[model samples]
Target: MSRIIRNLVSLALLLTAMSVQAAPSSFDLVGPRLSVAVTRDGSTLPLEWVPNLAEGDRVAIKLDLPAGQSDRFRLVAAFLRGAVDRPPDAWFHDTVSGKTKGGDLSLVVPKGAQQLVLFVLPERGAGRNAIVSAVRKQPGTFVRAVQDLNQAALDRARLDTFLDLLFRIGRQDPDSVNAASQVLTRSLAIKLKTECLQQPPELQAACLTGDRETLLFADTHSSALADTLTGAPVDLAFQLSATPQGGYGSYSSYIGVVRDILRLFGAFQSSQLRFVPALARMGDGRLTLLLNTPLSFAKPASVMVVGLPAIEAAKPPPLQAAAGVPLLCAAPDTVLPVEGAPLVYATRYAHDMVLRVAPDGAAGFDLPVHADARRGGFVLDRALPDRSAGATIDARIAGRWGFTPFDGPRFKLSDPRVNRWTAAPRASLVVGRSNAVTLTGEGAGCIDGITMQRGDAAAQAVSWKQDDANTIVVDVPLDKATPGTVTLTVTARAPAPPVSIVLPALQEVGRIDGVAYAAGDESAVLTGSRLDQVREVRAGKATWRPGALTRAAGADRLTLLPVDPAAAQVLTAGERIVADVTF
Candidate 1:
């Protein structure tokens, strides 16, 4: 096994040397059987399984090596944070000269490390810097290879768990089995083929244990799959076993099927059949998804959109797309195609739009690609903005070979007021003072400039500074202005409309005198500064709204007719008056 692994590594290195553009094949990398055991929080993961790593994780990597050839080679482990390679000194190194057929190296996963690369070189060949330089030349290939490795490891773990579940279901009593087993027997079994089961007496015995190879061939090569490969209209089942006349072929040994499934998953993780999801705000302000595909494979045979749980969910619920509730968010048998031209594919896919997660339990929508004369991509609908935070959408595209799943775009919901105000700049402002106000809300950071205009006067420049992501400070000069409305037009960064805030100025309205209600009087007399500015007045259980203010020569006075005349007329010292006044 070690010799085979060595040869595979040699082939990979040779390929890299021959062509800089050559992708590091996962097949070659997988042969090394690079098993990593991550020790985190005092617990060590099982061998050959690699989980997502966090900071402060200590990883133990064991590599199989050819016996006599060990002395001639050195294993270099490179840790990467995205495309940025870690310093050469931080990389792990081990000389493969052990008496045993295997060598082990231990290292902390390190802060911000998202990828790991392991390769063997001649002990005397290139120095560490030289190796680093080569990796820098094609960082994307190495990064992609690492992602594929991690995904393959995770998929293998899942497959093992699935097999374990099957074994448990067989060994345990029907009543004692778990919900997962119950789902398999009650819901999943109906989708299987009766021929595979062979009849009632042998249903559990023959069907549960079937030939994987024959089953895969039967399902994958069916008429529906053939139609899909040829770009014909066919409603194909998303899973292998769920297809018509198809089942997990009664595999005598489960190893072959598991390998096949892992390989399939590996291909999905690779860049070979590239599919990327993006978010776009159209001219009409519609937020959409841009499902970018390579020009060579631009037209997918079929596309399906799956609504996912809040992206932050630690464990998302299993996807169950029945016929009516199609994950595609369309009626059954509906065939949606890519809606952009090849040139649009070239121009649009170049963007670095990343997928974001929507809030948990947020509503999901279908995002299909679209294009016009000037712009082209998936146009996000209004539903996206309405969704709660952390919600995520996903998609599956069927190519000539098989179905490949990709993540859809995400959104962070914002107040709708931000949209209308930016274009017209209408918000309330107070007069007779220079107001230093801190504006805090969504899209506050987008405000690059602020201007204050009183009535029809020329726009006066205002000094404003961004304090944080959601806060901006603006100083409005209104001390000289008389009581009236002022429009504060706020300018956002390019592409966002400027918002106008219309401020109707009113003098301070809080001054108060005694409120008196004579037994024979028709209403109570309330006196205060800016008596006309008070919209409503509340005292004890009695609430009063004045029709209009009638001011005397001495003071501003208003007669308040209580809405509830039968309630208590007396006002407490604490609750003597609570008025709603506009500025």
Candidate 2:
């Protein structure tokens, strides 16, 4: 009996081990409890608990199994809509529809399924220990499913009918018809063409009429056709009539009637539909009727029936005679004359006006007044006047009537002529037999004294003595003047061009006073007479240098020093320092 008990206990233990190794049996799973937690290592697993699911909800199942070697075990998480009793080891495996995480498995609960059963297991001849979990449907999924059903139903027959009407209207014009037909054919080829039979009859009729009632349906239902017909009802209608005729009137009459209908319909339609505004003019007067809306959508058939009224011309302002100005005889009446004044009168007839200026000192057909004159009479209806100064005459009067003062005679100033200079060149002089300087205008003039400092001064100033009317002569002396630069300035109303003088270099005769000596010598005295020939001492010598010496007696003596004993000496003690200098 003890042996028998041992056998039974061992058997029970074996059964318990088998139960632990077995996968859970197929069971119904739903949402709200279904969830996946992704780990930092990119491994994902479904929750341990099953969820309450609704129809159309998705469930993601994951299994945490080793990668690469995972293919050795074919694992699947199967969800059945109904309950089933099956062995855990006998669970079936299904190929996952998407990416798997280490033998992961997922299954969606179908819309028609009332319950779901999930199985996690390996394929035939596979290893074990692959854990699978899944997500289940929730209330939000059911709500979305209902919404989708309603939207699908909403996108039906009515929309198709509206698009059909649009297609019909876009076929009237040859070019538009061809273009739309091509598009339709291409769409049909692509299997994207919509069927008119799917649309409701009421929406179809509204689309045919191009009525506003169909707009909302068109917008939501047929984006392309809706965009085409946004503002283009007239054109759309014409296109529809041009299509192969089966319904409505004959082709020619159909066109005429549609044209007439468009015209009549346009009257009620907003101005925004018409492309061009109406314009009218009478006798050069312009009338513009500004339509407030842009007509990018529709174009009118013709402007003749629109009937734009011609605009009347604006009347010109009434003519007012200038104060104290004469009013010459006008065509219809005799006007009184204002003494010592010019007259101007303005009149208007219809779109035309005339401005009349009476003859003051001259008579002419037409003349323009000076633009600068504030009070002059102007003929706005005629050409501008000549600005040149001249005598004006009325030939009928046989005498010159208008004369511009200072027009023909010459005037002279009583002041003496003065020469002006500005920015004159160095060594320039205004007086002393220089070139004649022309004076521009009459003004008080001043003369600036000549300045001398530069070596090029050869010009000198002398007294200005007037000789005759518009003529003056100035005597200048350049002899005995320092050979340097000088400038003369004269101020007057207007200046003449400047005169410049360049002096030749003067050859100076200079004297030297010594024979060459060592450069270190402090002083070497020299005696010489006739040293006035020296323009500079110790010039043109290689090393002889002149030095200041304090002389107690006789002529002031010049000491000399030499840079080297080889330098030439032209003077000796007691000999005159005779130096020929060219000045």
Candidate 3:
């Protein structure tokens, strides 16, 4: 029996050497560059060759399973480090028969292992399993495995894939058992407090029972106690309880309960959630939520009741309104500085007066009642001297003053009289009834001279012509004098390039005395120094008859007159100046 054992051991050693010698080259040992093929069952398994792996090298074996299969399958890989005794870094259960599902799986191998083993299983049952086997390579096989797996990691490696998928599925199909489990895990992990958990039987239900009322209370009173709570701006107004498919109240109420619970739980985790269920107002009116505890770590206990007055009702009015006062005067006037103590009359009486007076004695008053009186009916009873009486009686009676008096009895003391008595200069030019024949110079400058029309036909009319240097003068008919003021406009030419006229800053010259003046239906007089040399006296384009021009031969003035009366009558309104001057 001893001899047989020795021979068997030698045979085993020979077979082991042959197997090692039969190992493929580094290129062949590392199979297909660790290509990952995702199976129809959603397992992403990597098949790679371990090159030159010695009998005692420690290595990590990574088996990547599809997103939802990591927790369900058992990962088994041979020739790996820390495989037999579970290592802290190992992501999969080493003793499990199949691989984990719901995420990617990884395992470490113990030394002296020859082949790698991997097993993948479905999430729920034990039947479906994907098996992967890989050969161990010599010399830095562990590092190579890690490198190859790192590249393949993207194929099945996602940190929150399972969680996100769980959420998506749960939202879509809340009744799914897998989705429920996922949601429960997520909720528990995040420590979310749901309204579903807070309700007590049917009576305590968030949506069905009066939980919605409680939520509304929290929202309306959020501003009052927001500072004291951990979370604020809680959007409790949205009908979160109602699902799209469910009836209005049913869906919103249900979702609202869940959302509220989540908010509360979020607050609890962040140390911010404050539940001070008091009273709050809705569009319909008020509601109350009874918060069981002042502050507690354990789940909150609360109840809701409709038609409760908000906490704001218990507090006094806001501080801003405290300063407001009701005023009581109608048509109040500001007190002004006067030489004498003038008795001013009020337009209407006030039961109580509230005045906001400025430093300058300008006062604004609020009226207690509407005034029903008309204007100018109430007058001030004050005496004035004959000289002081010249001061115009102009008064700003505050209560809707109009031109006409009111039909009611006049209040003599109600209207205030303002005295303005200052002498002003009389106008040089008056609008009505003047006997003097006024002739306005048209065109540029002031009128210098005037001449009377001479000839056989001129005796029939009273005609006095004015001489405006290089301009026309308006000839106002003295015999048939008009009552109103007649405006005579002259063509005021802008000065030549070298000459600029500086207009008087204080006084506006209404009409230029000379140049070319045109009045209604009367002959205009054009007079200048070189009147006879002017070939064409054109206003705009049409020619004008030359008016009498005084040609002085050594201080002897000779008047050259217009021979045509028809040409003089052609000059009409606006600036009538001679254009295209020849001389």
Q: In terms of TM-score, which candidate is stronger, 2 or 3?
A: 3
lDDT at position 169, candidate 2: 44
User: How does each model score on lDDT?
Assistant: 0.40, 0.28, 0.26
Error of 1 at 173 (Å): 11
**Cα miss at 204, model 1 (Å)?**
6.3
Worst 10 residues of 2 by lDDT: 397-406
Displacement of residue 28 (Cα, Å) in model 2 is: 24
Candidate 1: segments with Cα more than 4 A from true spot: 1-35, 40-50, 64-74, 83-89, 97-103, 120-134, 163-195, 198-210, 213-583
| Top-down TM-score ranking | 1, 3, 2
Q: How accurate is candidate 2 locally (lDDT)?
A: 0.28
The worst-scoring run of ten residues by lDDT in candidate 3 lies at: 338-347
Predicted structure 3: lDDT: 0.26
Count of clashing residue pairs in every prediction: 29, 38, 52
- Per-residue lDDT for 1-583 in model 1, tens only? 9999999999999898887533222221111223455676686653222213556767676544445544344455666665554344565455453525645678776666665565544445444455565456556545554443333322222222333454555455433233333333222121222353334432342344332212211222343542333321211111222111111111111112222333433343322222121111121111122222211222321111111001110211121222222112111112222221111121221122222332345553343333211121232222233333321133332111001122322222232224233221444555555666666544552345688887788998899765543556678877667888777787754444677777676555457775666643457777866566666666556767775566565466878787776764454334434544331
lDDT of 3 at 122: 25
| lDDT score of residue 203 within candidate 3 | 24
Best by TM-score: 1
